[model samples]
Target chain A: MSDDKLERTERALDFSGIQAPEELLRMKRATPARIGIGHVGARYKTAAALRFGADHAAANDAAFSEVPEDIPARLGFFSVQTLCRDKAEMITRPDLGRYFDEEQKARILSSCRYAPDVQIYCGDGLCAPSIAANIPDLYPAIRDELVFRGISVGTPFFVRYCRVNTARVIGPLLNAEVVCVLIGERPGLLTSESMSAYIAYRPHPDMQENAYTVVSNISRFGTPPVEAAAYIASLIGEILEKKKSGLSLKQNEE
Target chain B: MKDVLMSAGIDIGTTTTQVIFSRLTIAEKGGFGAAPGYAVTRRDVFYRGRVHFTPLLPDDSIDKEEVARILSEEFESAGLRPDDMDTGAVIITGETLKRANAKEVAESIAALSGRFVVTTAGPHLESVLAGKGSGAAELSTRTGKLVANVDIGGGTSNLCFFDDGAVLDTACLDLGGRGIRIENHKIAQIFPGTKRILEAESIRLSVGDSADLPSVRERIENLADVMARLLAEALLLLPESPTLRKVVTNRLITCDRIPEIVTLSGGVADLLGNLPEDPFRYGDIGAFLGASIARNGAIRERLNRNTKETLRATVIGAGNESLTLSGGTVFYQEIAFPLRDLPVVTLPMDGANPEAYGEAIGRAWERIREDGETTAAFASEGLSAPTYEEICRLADAAAKAARQKDPSGSQTWVFVFATDMGKAFGQAFRRRMPPKTSILAMDSVRCGDEDRIDCGDPIGRGDVIPVVVKTLLFDNGERETI
Candidate 1:
């Protein structure tokens, strides 16, 4: 093909996806799933392929990026680090991400109140962008709900290179009756900016995996952060009342 | 996987009254813990009552006792009771709404039928419902073409245009099958509107006139010709005829494009098919009107003969097409579970400054207030792809607006959202606004500029609510479409 002709073909290959019927259009609008996108033979259309590539790149970037330094100060929370020394270590050694370093543990012990009603910790898990995007709205909503309900809250803080299980370590250390860690979820091809909350009441080192109650998918496209915060605050009140989390709480609710 | 609601529809028209029983199935399509929502996945009409001449009293008022008796008998034959109904509508249509006791009769039937049955009347709404019932709305969606449903009943012809399953515009005319009533093959009475038209056409017709005369047939043809001309004017967007304009009721054709297809519905529509060939059928000129429409060359060329319904459209639409299921993720206080007939005001939010959102909402609320609608629901097409910060901003603005309107925070603030962000925004608004302000915020309820909504108690484990949207703002001065 001639160069000009090739350029034209490439430009024309910019298929604008599918033309769905009105009924299907309503269904498609209500969801974020990749549906009704017509294919070019066996492959996805060029536009859809390009979009997938872009979303994948975003997910990888979110997984590797560090939380910005000023985020903690902006949110009025102090920062600490897990035993995982750096990003590479955090990715390779999952076990190390669940514990705090000795020095950081002492700092936490000094700064946080003992056996408070609720202890909140922000963690940059697999995706830092999720934390960066959601925390400002989520933090205040959670605080206001808990405060209005007359629940005592300990000093809030942030953790770097943290895993969800870090709540198992921090909860017992601060003698917290209930601990909630809002951590970044593993990035997906569709969304990298999603967060999840892990709540445990009186968590112990040997607590089973099912001991924690989790509310996941907090993002712009998911259960939005502000709403999730309200739900979490109410869940905490239930946890404190029933003195249970996870399976027990679920059973109690049923 | 699906929940079924048994619904009933009672349509009281000028000459005939009928009942319909339908089954609406709501299906949950949301994936586990994902964007949860429910929709009316299927609707089926199971029972259709035999059409009967409407019972009227000496004063031309509806016979309430006789109407209730007919409904009870129909319910018993259908093997259903009033308590079996989940939600439905009782519509008083056409000239029947002009009856002395029309509202009272409709209200009585609604009370006797079910807990959530809605009663409404008006030319515009009747037009829209008939169009939906006649399947013009669904046809528009299937064919991707504009369709107009013209319901020619006893005392009115209601015209409603639909595009892609949504009502576009509606018009009504005081032309129907019973414009002139015939008794024992003689003219018993002529409606004043029909008399004026006959005088203008130079046709001598009066009460007690011989119905067997050729000029009487010509008068009937004249009424049919008027109907045809008015329809042409409405469909072609032509200027109204000076003589015909007097009979034009409600809004006129405002849609930019002409309808590609037309469907005829109502009792007069029964004449389009084989209807026992009785000229004095039901003691009205309905048969002649239907014959005139079928033979009118202007209308014949445009009519789509294969309609989904004829006389049953209004009843079917009222029974099955009226109720919509709200989105699953919504916020509602227990105290405000079943709010009815709250007018909806759509706030302009597109390309608007974030700071001015409160002022825009305040202005919209004030407009509704001027209409003496004290408690109203504020509706908006929420921010698209809103980020957490954007949500907070919108919520803050909404909180400010609510507080400014009700400083004491003792009243309940209702908001309807066309986007999936209702729960999020409701939570933020609750947290920011004064503690005393009760919030009833819901999503996925689409409202037009002139629409009002009735919200029923939450259903499906409190996951969604039943909402009925009534379009009533057509008479309000022109406004931009949202």
Candidate 2:
């Protein structure tokens, strides 16, 4: 698989007119911290703390916001919940997480717009904090990319413990060429704010193991939230046009 | 003269022990002396240690001696004696066999009884038995064929792979029913009836920190989950071989069908009540084995398909060595059969018993000894029995430490070493994780860090024991290109 650079031509906007001193940029630059345990001692915690701050910003900033007003209006998409009562119920009862819960099912039935080229979802997943942090800028970036490509992203929703394969659970629920689920991964002591996106070609429950793709470690310390969102949108486009996600899809086939 | 011989066999295993007794008449040829004394009884035995009846420590102090003596006394009370004249065998297993001078103890017992013989079947014996009795036999009989068996016992499990009947590879583990019992405290807590029985018998079942009722139930369910996945991996190993199958204690449970029958002989099996009919349709094996010899083939086929030769599996297969086994005697041609080559498709596990426990145990014993060796054959390589909770603790501790170091969930991966190990631990972990997340396992696995060493750069220095989660992502520029 070749990691070829895609075309990018950035024109700097004239932010100089808005006026923030260039010296202020240098005054308080963010630094990442590192932490270590057992015999490693406390020296690493500084780096860890710094990293945590950056990760939190990336997760919580507007760049990663997944608020309601953003979709449908700008990207021609809507959102729904996994039909579960709440996060606590979803954790206690995974079967409910597998399907839409009563109220959630009804909400989706009434609110979700029908028949789009693809459907996208955001799940609190195992690491909801991470998803919340990344959604601000990431969601808009992905939506803009899809809209630019003239691809209609159908009603999207959030999931909990929403496995990569949970996309399959919603595949039949929404008829589309592809489904992308941006969910929280299990938390880690280093940073509980990491998120992952699992994209499947068909999104059927019976899909093969290799039928999905993942973009993990999407916090600031890992991949930048906006870059991850852009990549996810690109992946959705690939799945729609080439019809593939995981190992089976050749790295450069498309 | 319609004289019937009633005999029982007790096989004490690492994870669980079982006692089976049956009554069968030997057809007399020519003229018989003393009319065979109104029923010549030949009792077969395959037993495992139990939390209630057997001591937990690896040492053989008063408990070992008491167990042996109690068994002898019980037999005497059941109208069995040296003078009664016939054949009988006993398997002194696991830690009991590790006692200092354990073999001497067995020899002494054998000499004293005259009618009774003592033997030891190590961890490998079960695989050897499965090879002869299940799909291993078929794999052996066929040229250019491979087969595997994943046997889940109470305290340990076995993964035996074979080319034809010859053993290509074998792995044993400490994970089994005992692990399940300990890891899943909920099984005990949920079934207070079982706890009451244990309490009445003065058995202190240490379920660790999980003493609450809900946690106890969760653990039992976890055990079931582990059992199912481990069963799947064992079956997967024998891919393309129609014969390779997994074997449980009393009945054959295949992946294709729901469990139908189970024989409640061991400590865990005895406590089961109101199991689902959809899954356990055949009921109890103890009840089924007693009715006729018909049920033997179903389980036998399941066991024989993986052997180098499709031979009958039993401890008696050891009798093929021509040594006078500690147990009963078997005439030639009874078990001296050649192996077959072919995959043995499996039926799901079955656990149902409507007959008396005594009769059930007796019947299983008859099937065992009638085939000769008076034991179930298994593979030895890596076989050791540890509790399920112990395994989970090990995995959890390792996974947690790894996570702490690599919070991004990168630079490491958790690879289940043994198929059985993966299933056991994955079952427990799934209950705690998101539903879609599955435990990753190696194609052919091991127990300790040896697999990691073999993996080398794939798993660097920080790699933990029993888990080697990888972190390599292949990124190809297809999305933008498309």
Candidate 3:
């Protein structure tokens, strides 16, 4: 690396004007927040402004981009599309992203197994790169852990222009006891590659928001994909034992 | 919202021995459902014992029996027993560790002092502890300035540099108050190390010399000048002078940056900056030397002088300042809940070269084997939020390196983290390892390359573990650097 790049990476966020810079540094290390970046009078310093702009652009790109075709094919899983036709339509119509189109639904029903113990799927929610970056590590870990516990998982697949609620749509179709969707998170300035796992036990169309439990920020700069995968698998085990998810499962755990 | 524990600190120094008792309140700081983060919310010293002369035998070895008696008496007077202390340390400091029976004495005291008291001695550890007790650590954190603490006890002057509450470097010199012994207002004997200072100045002062003589005062002033000059050179990171080289105990001074402030602690510190007119009050040249230090122009101009304790810094640090709380998001086996005195081997994980993990771990394992140590804790600073593939690669490398060292898999593999990803990393590592292999992982324990750690059982239902990280030199090979 160039000396300037090395120096920039090593240097901590400058909070010289603050009375307690160590406190600010400690807080900054705890999270990936844009705090402690000292301002230049009325605005952020030039470097800080440039970094913010770059992150924002990356987030925009993640939200509008399409999931690559080779990722799912390489994993031996076929892909299906939601009712939304394109990225613009997916953004405009939230309901269309939640459910598959008539033809795509028929393809999923014919290709996937029925009444499995667990069903896993991937989605390009708001950031397709999140799935492309995280799933290779996450999917295998979750699959292996569940298999080790003797839980049968259904034929996993991918959903294009997917939403968090897509797990609810697929759960009843596959007749699975548990459904989990690993989808891209809505991008933020701190990170555009962050992903989230939304899980529900015996999800149905009439299920309330509390029926689903989410573990978010699965990225290189967030929870770490391998660790998050293990955590999600453990949560799935608990959900199977208790036959519940979200608020009820959390309360029972306490 | 906090759990309280009783602690005790005992310091056995060259000239004096003392004990202190304190209370530490540990509490969780993060919001509900957040990853576990616990800290020592409050530390309060409840009792401070009287300073007693270190009992010595006729052979110049520490009198272990007398020392134990004094400690028992003090504990009784304080209305506490050895079982009452939850955790603490009994540290032998200064030149006392050089005594023929120092280790035996230390071990005996550690056994009799408390339920979980640790015995430690070394210049670097002493320097850091003294700095913490003298308030230099706190001052550095508050002011964001580098502060050097010089703790001049009876046998050695230990210098520890602190930046933002962390120890950066350490050095030790054979400079102290009790180097010259006096009796009946006359010089009874001068230690061999102190004799070098007199000879360097071309002043011939020997046993039976009158303490009231002008030559004695001049020798004391010269000693003070040597100490001040040593500090000046250390701040500039220069090689030691010929005079300083003769009295140097440890040559390690790793920090390149000069300190903005300097603090004085230990026995002779009370006399500095404001010397008593009666110089012979202690029957030695300690008062005179303190006065010389106060009058030293270079030290006064270059560094700001500040201090919180004199003669009690090491004891206070041992009793109250040594304990740290680990983060709650940890993974460990129930059987290995409390592990002590494990040497910390920090793995180089700069992430610049992805292929170096196996090689780096192999090199570290070789060093651990060379040291004849079977169990060690591997530590790293930046394992936070790594990609899944990266974590798997690291786990694979770690497992392979560990297996190479002990193919039987009988040893416990402990991983220490400086970041908040211990739970995640531990889970990932466990998924890759055999079920029979024991794994213990903890986070938020900041340790240096040369430090050793003692892990206590988790507190209550929280996942936080009580840890004491220290640098101790028990063997001759480790004594090369303080």
For lDDT, the strongest prediction is 1
Strongest candidate by TM-score: 1
Alpha-carbon deviation at A134 in model 2, angstroms: 91
Put down candidate 2 lDDT per residue, A1-254, tens digits, no spaces.
00110000001112233344332222222112121111224343343445445555643432223333443334333445554555566567666666755666566656665657777777766665565567664566566557756898776665544545567666776666777777776665345667777778777877786777777766654554644564566567777877777766545442
Q: Against the unseen true structure, what C-alpha lDDT does each candidate score?
A: 0.79, 0.40, 0.77
Ranking by DockQ: 3, 1, 2
Best by DockQ: 3
TM-score of structure candidate 3: 0.80
DockQ of 1: 0.20
The RMSD of every model to the true structure, in order and in angstroms, is: 5.9, 30.4, 5.3
Candidate 1: C-alpha RMSD after superposition: 5.9
TM-score, chain A, per candidate? 0.88, 0.65, 0.88
What does the lDDT read for residue A35 in candidate 3? 68
Q: Rank the candidates by TM-score, best first.
A: 1, 3, 2
Can you write out model 2's per-residue Cα lDDT over B29-87, one digit (the tens) per residue?
21311101121233233322122344444443325565566556655655565444333
Residue lDDT tens for model 3, B1-482:
33898889899998899999999987766442233357787888889999999999988899999999999988998999998888888888877888888878877876773355565568777888898998899988877788888888887888888888888888887777777888886888687768776677565667887767777767666766665666556555345567766776766466678877877888778887555776767766677567666776655664455587778999998888888887765766534656877888887775445457667777877888798887788888956556656666777777777677667667788888886656556766666666667888878788867678888767834467788887776324464222
